[model samples]
Target: MTTQPDHGQELIPRPERTPEAVRVALARVAPHRISDMERHKEQALTAAIADGKIGHLRHWLTYWQAQVEIERRPDLSARYRAALTAVHGTSSNDDPAFRSAMNELAAVEAEAQRAVSA
Candidate 1:
């Protein structure tokens, strides 16, 4: 039987291979968003496939697991947080920071897309 490589182990060195922007994006995927998609994976996949996109079960597993390594690294987390705060402004102490940050990041990413295609 051919054994599969443990991708989690293989991915440990991946962040260094990417540019800072990519590293920040990976580290900063909001866990709550991941959870929401996971909760509705069946429907999301069906809709995505209907729209001819490549979404599938476990499509996010690799990236989500990669988050662990990203978050564990102090350098990556610091960069991620900085990038997020820059795009999103600041949240108060009692606010839900991750959600706020993700919303801001999404807006920033969308604006970038618009500018690029304009």
Candidate 2:
């Protein structure tokens, strides 16, 4: 029912109604619509596919935290808390804020492991 602002043609619901809620949604499909993304979409798709695969990372992290001695290792506790906070903050994996939180948590695990050896 919606008409173009300048033209007499009616707007199609698919393109007009679909809001780009996530990067993957925008990258995989919206790329054709956006001139700037015409060059970057393939790269974005590759990165998005890899990034989307959590593969029980959150579960493993929780297990690592519980199995490790957090009382003796403060670093482990820090990682546990970081993961908990990250998971609690958002459910959307594509969200920028959530990605930042997860990246911070991912680093915490390595830092904790280093502490165990040191």
Candidate 3:
């Protein structure tokens, strides 16, 4: 099993980036989102099979894998939601708070991307 470095501390086991793995992780971390996950999986599978291209399915798996990583970390998940709320609460994109919230959201997303890609 592959392990990811956790800030020079003990290595964290990296979950397999597969549909089954994602489902299991979702069950453990976000059980309520399982149906949504299944819907996305079905859509990705249908698109891939119809087009004879696996890109859509692969993209779906990667996206969900990143989401699983984010959800696994409570701090990251909370920060992500808070940043989203801040961004959504703003009336105008021109507002400084909006930009700050967007930056925070992007940073959290980047962390998730690293977690998955690692």
Which candidate model has the greater TM-score, 1 or 3? 3
Q: Give the residue spans of candidate 2 off by over 4 A.
A: 1-71, 74-79
Best by lDDT: 3
Please list the C-alpha lDDT of all candidates, in the order they appear.
0.46, 0.43, 0.80
- Residue-level lDDT tens digits of model 1 in 1-116: 11222333322333332324333444454444444435555665687778877554344333333453445445445555676775466455446765666665455445333322
lDDT string for model 3 (11-108, tens) is 23446877787788778877898988889989999999999999999889888887777787777788899999999999999989999999998898
**Top-TM-score candidate index:** 3
Candidate 1 error regions (>4 Å)? 1-34, 40-55, 90-118
Q: What's the C-alpha lDDT at position 89 in model 3?
A: 96
Q: Please state the error at residue 65 of candidate 3 in Å.
A: 0.7
Which regions of candidate 3 are displaced past 4 Å?
7-13
Question: What are the models' TM-scores?
Answer: 0.35, 0.35, 0.81
RMSD vs true structure, all candidates: 11.2, 20.3, 2.9
